[model samples]
Target: MKKSRILLSTALIMVLSASSVYAHPGRTDSNGGHTCRTNCTERWGLEYGEYHYHNGGSSSSNSSSTSKSSNSSSSVKKSGQSAKEIATQKAKKAQQEKEAAVKKAKQIKQAEKDGYADGLKDGYNGISNIGISKYQGAYNKGYKEGFAKGKLKLTNEKNKAYRAGYSAAQNGKSSVVPSIYQTNKALSDSYLQGFERFVIDVEKQKYYQMGYNDSFNMEKYIKPDFDNANHIRWYKEGFDAGKKKQAA
Candidate 1:
């Protein structure tokens, strides 16, 4: 009873009694219509707000809850996307490195193949070119070129013979292999046919056969003329001279 009286006294002090009302923006005329003409929804919302404030009932905070949930969902999705992107980038980088390594390996293999000296020389003519002759002279300058080359080789062979003899001496050898050096193309071709004919004749000889098997490849070119009839004339003469000296 004492608490009730105290609450009543507090309400009586706070609540306004009947007094002269001020004529303001939202005031009504004698007819009770608002001067400012506030909207019905707006007035109803203000009345509802006043009722909530005074009653002190529990209020739902759904808007705040929905905003928080939306934010959390967005954050989760962003984090998941970041993880996937990072993984994808790593995979792509790894693939690039693998491809690069494969390319480097292929390049290395190709380089190794290119390193062979024999393969490097395939583009040029080889030792087999020794068989060619300056026989044809259909072109005007051809014969002159061949003649000039022959003359030059004849001159060079003198010097070559000295060198060959020296080199042969180092080997403690009595003979030279392919003893003539044909420095020029024409030099080789000058005695080409005569050399061929001499080789054919020597191969036919029984004594020459017992000495050396092949004839096309002679021991060396000799200055004393060679042909089919005189294949071993030089050799037999040399043998006879040696025998005479030994008997002496």
Candidate 2:
């Protein structure tokens, strides 16, 4: 019985050894390249032509598979790199476009402010000059036509200034004033005085009509009768108030 047990133990040891070898089918060859172990191709059921072993234990088929795997890995890396570069370029381009849009908006707003400020100052100066030169005799029939034309001129200027102010405010550039507020205020004061005492009923109507046509936002004056001195004063006050408010 003891001899029979020893034989059974030897057979079990041989089975375990064969299993370990079969599980590990790879080994280094004489040429320092990887190859299948002896009898591995047959044990794994691989065809002889697909995994033929030479005397040096090298496998041509396995070497070709390793090369193909390496090439596939390299190609995947290259494709990933190209996609990343394209995404980076698109991000840069989008940023540049956003910056350009902001810059253009700023420039357009600045231009609008410049136009308004220049028109206000020039119009005020011209109106003041006309008041000094023409208001004394505007009641005469011969001078009435020229007086009407002069009011239209001043109305055009006021319209230009108000339109620009509105546009600048709308474009988010309201804080940047192209003209001096104090200068506008002082000019408005003089215009208010001239509008009160020198302007007659017909002239006031003409001015009010002109305001309704083009300068409604800048000047809102109603026609005043001879007895309503208070109404005339209100017209000047309204003009000054509108100017100061817009400039601010």
Candidate 3:
């Protein structure tokens, strides 16, 4: 009975050693796995060319699952980075737009100020409101108002000059502008205009009276030595009227 037990134990050891050799027949790969080559279906119950892991190594399916999980995590991380980049770009763009708006506002304000100043000066100088075409918006409005004011002021000054010249001429003074108006071309021209009108009126009256007296005395009609055509025309008309009245 003792010999039979020892023999049984030896047989058990041989069986275990043969099973260990058969289970790991070929060399393992980096993943502790290799393809089945010899006795694939009979020894290991695996198909030919099938890959399997050994010694607690992970299976290809498990590696695939882990790889998929890792890729998913990497993809999530990349997605988060992309989102952050987009937000940063949007913030930078908003700041740029705000700066541009402020710059535009300053330019507009400066333009408005320059336009008003130019308009005021041009209006006061009596220059034409050409700023209407040269400038826009508030400038044109200011130019028109200034032009009206300047024209009114010029008109008042001309009226005063005309009155002074008319009084001088009626008093038999020389047709000359006063010293005060000589410095101003507009006023000087207006004064000369008034003085000439009064002188012409007096000359015209004298010619009419002379023509009337000659017609009453039945003298021959003769043209006067007047340089003015209007004066000669007035004399002829008066002579004709006097002849008509005498005949009536």
Candidate 4:
């Protein structure tokens, strides 16, 4: 009987220890929670010393809250990244546009410069046709200004050539256009016109003076060379006028 009683006592102690192992017996804190210390994995499926609730608290609710927080954080991060990407794109586009504008401006400047040079050359040479250009407006503006300047220069040069020809004729020099004006038809024509005017004036004055002197002295009429029809006509006209003056 004594041995059976001792055996029953041992069995009762074993049952109590087993129940304690599974029961998680501990004084509850203010939040009805405590750290797992016994059979943590087997009884609660948790790590040792991990905090958990046991007063009908739902772990799924806590898990859902944590998941929602993580999702919110992820969304914020994604939004920040998206905004940064947009800003980067905007900056890149702006830079490209700025570069393109600068390139266009440079092209316009170059076109104007080329047009001015071409227009100056053409105008100076008396050319009338203006060719095509990529930047037509800028090129046309430059061309107009250049053409005006070139035309003025040509006019001044032509006038200078005329004066030179007139002086040469007045000094009885050869009626030859200068080598400088030989290549330009306009200047050559101007020089020739001046030379002819001076020669005609001198011939008329000489014929008129000779007729007057002869008539006043009562000399016989001296005729001019008939090789030039103009000389003959001028001499005859002068002789008639001088005769009338003497009679009056």
Per TM-score, the best of the predicted structures is 4
- List RMSD in Å for every model shown: 23.1, 23.4, 14.4, 15.3
lDDT of 2 at 220: 48
Clashes of each: 0, 0, 0, 0
Off by over 4 Å in 3: 1-126, 132-135, 219-221, 225-228, 244-248
The digit string of per-residue lDDT tens for model 2 on 140-166 reads 322344444555666665555555544
- lDDT tens digits by residue: candidate 1, 60-90: 5555654454344232111125677899999
Estimate TM-scores for all models: 0.25, 0.24, 0.47, 0.55
Assess each prediction's global lDDT (C-alpha) against the native.
0.41, 0.48, 0.71, 0.75
Model 1 reaches what TM-score against the true structure? 0.25
Give the number of colliding residue pairs in candidate 4.
0
- What order do you get sorting by lDDT, best first? 4, 3, 2, 1
Residue 194 miss distance in model 4 (angstroms): 2.4
| lDDT tens digits, residue span 87-178, model 3 | 99999999999999998767666555655566555554456654443336555555555566666777788888988887889998998677
Candidate 2 lands at a TM-score of 0.24
Q: Candidate 4: where are CA atoms >4 Å away?
A: 1-81, 208-248
Q: Per-residue alpha-carbon lDDT of model 4 for 1-248, expressed as tens digits? A: 99999999999999887555435766657654566677777776666666655533334557665455444423211112567789999999999999999999999998888778878877887786676899998898888878877888888988888888888899989999989989888889889888888888899888767666666666567676669777777777777788888779
Of candidate 4, the 10-residue stretch with the lowest lDDT total is 71-80
lDDT score, candidate 1, position 198: 43
Q: Estimate the TM-score for candidate 4.
A: 0.55
